[model samples]
Target: MKRLALTTASLALAAGMAFAAEHETTVRMGTEGAYPPYNFLNDSGEVDGFEIELGNELCARAELTCEWVTNEWDSIIPNLVSGNYDTIIAGMSITDERDEVIDFTQNYIPPASSAFVGTSEDADLTGGVVAAQTATIQAGYVAESGAALIEYATPEETVAAVRNGEADAVFADKDYLVPIVDASGGELMFVGEDVQLGGGVGMGLRESDTELKASFDAAITSMKEDGTLNEMILKWFGEDAATYE
Candidate 1:
């Protein structure tokens, strides 16, 4: 009887420890460390970008010890639901389809346009071979707009396809492609009208993580209220870019 009591106590203690662990203190922030200007690996090979800056600020405001984790964009949401990370800080636009699967904080970045770039000034805007990163809103738009869509695993690969003539053009977030076009020295240029899709970008969280979502949402609200988020938008996307305001 004494041995059984000791064993029961040990199991109860272990269960308590597990319960405590479920309420993790440190929040693991996830990002796609490949999207330049939004999130990317810097020369030092560390994740660096506007999202990284904003996420760190949010974490600070929330008084949470947050650590960054990189994941490919293709499987980012699935992985988040699987508990590979606690929160997704990538530049993911809030959409109804996505909302059904996961929860989002209020948008941090305001809605931005998506544009198509091609080598030819007169490239066909419709029914042309267009490249876009797989599973992105841009890809869905391309596919639905009577354009022949070719999906690539990464944004870089989609751009490469256009450059190599594998695709007639590439469609992506206008802000993400603007700097590339500018630096291309006339090699690349926008050829079609900018298409606006999806709501503004927000941090993704599992539906079960209501408390964590509230913390991030509060941080974002604080930034918006203080004009810091607008400042960040201008710093990263230029003065004309959209903001929470």
Candidate 2:
């Protein structure tokens, strides 16, 4: 899951109240179209990934017309607060700090671990320069864990830092790192213990949009009850990924 430290002003109540009137039939879903396995631009250059597929199903279940919107991770929340989108279905983790800015649906993905990947298996994680996406939970963890932290604007750049010898390791979601490591052949490998952080992944919405929130929440619960949610998780994250149980 992704967790960005938010510093923007809260959304106005007027905007939240206007949501139902302005888009009763349609919902705009904002995402960072870079993070793979969660949300990404496919070969056809359209948003396509696990979240894209699951979000469509969620919208259909809630009977709401939905459209996709792409934004930089750093500005994703601010844009939502300014009415650029109706909801955020990116790989954003549910955290108390974020809850102060926008409401979150009950977790759609269970809590997962953060991990470090480096070019070498013996990389010095405690003292080496570590790279992480700016304002992410992994970045914060790196800063406080005694490693010299380097921040990148995108997740790919963080991985690149390790490849280019600019960083000793790159820390991020273990699921996000898994495919990268596998594709690297022998170039990259996980270097440290998996660290658990954040609660889980969820949809971020304005506080006043309680009706829409309830609709989506009910849809999520229905999916959980019928086992579709678990099926989707395993489909994207493989058999070892966490589930609702």
Candidate 3:
């Protein structure tokens, strides 16, 4: 009877271990895979970008397995609220308006000033016709400043508009627009000083998921301390673009 009881206890312990091993918290992350150098598809059609690398690091630090879901840029928040994803890791800026609907982790990436680029070498539309993605901070700037706002669905569209002379200049985050400018082979040039966009990139979590948000904030802090964050930034944007401060 003693041997039988011991065998039963061992089986129970083994079953508990199996259950624990099989149970892993999965986090569904959303991103618009069109933002190059942030979260875009590569030539091979795989998601290979800065935000993707950073997301992997955050998942590792939090001890969670992440499933990335690509969505349209405009629908990222609506889909998040509709239960399409648990968190948003796209290069999303944290703003007062967004805060009303979702909670954000501490700024993992600081916001760089926005810049305007034009096709003409002497394109002096510093305060003239401005093109930015609709509903974005850049658009807000154009609206407030009374610039002719040419709205586009994506950054690529805005860039294309400038290249095709459909718009005078393209206004967007420097990190996103710089690569496009370089790739345009001198077709685009910076028109003016960078415009301040008072926000930073952060992980967007549902308001009710405070526990998950806290975990993500802690993981991001730990990664920043250990230099893992810097390394990934460098890998994506080169050494000069790794500033987190």
Best by lDDT: 2
Give candidate 2 misplaced runs (Cα > 4 Å). Answer: 1-23
Off by over 4 Å in 3: 1-25, 121-127
Question: 1 or 2, which is superior by lDDT?
Answer: 2
Reference-based lDDT, residue 60, model 2: 72
lDDT of each: 0.86, 0.86, 0.78
lDDT of 3 at 33: 89
Instruction: For residues 139-180, write the lDDT of model 3, one tens digit per residue.
Output: 887878767888888888888888788888888888888777
Pick the winner on lDDT between candidates 2 and 3. Answer: 2
Clashing pairs in 1: none
1-245: candidate 1 lDDT, tens digit per residue: 64664454445434433433676567889999999889999999999999999999987766677889999999999999999998888889999999999999989988889999989898776978999999999988888889899999889998899899999999999989999999999989999688889998999999997767776776777677668989988999887788764
Distance from true location, Cα of 118 in model 3, Å: 0.4
Kindly list the per-residue Cα lDDT of model 2 for residues 83-141, writing each as its tens digit.
Answer: 99989999998888899999998899999999999988889999989999986888888
Candidate 2 colliding pairs:
none
Query: Distance from true position, residue 16, model 1, in Å?
Result: 23
lDDT of 2: 0.86
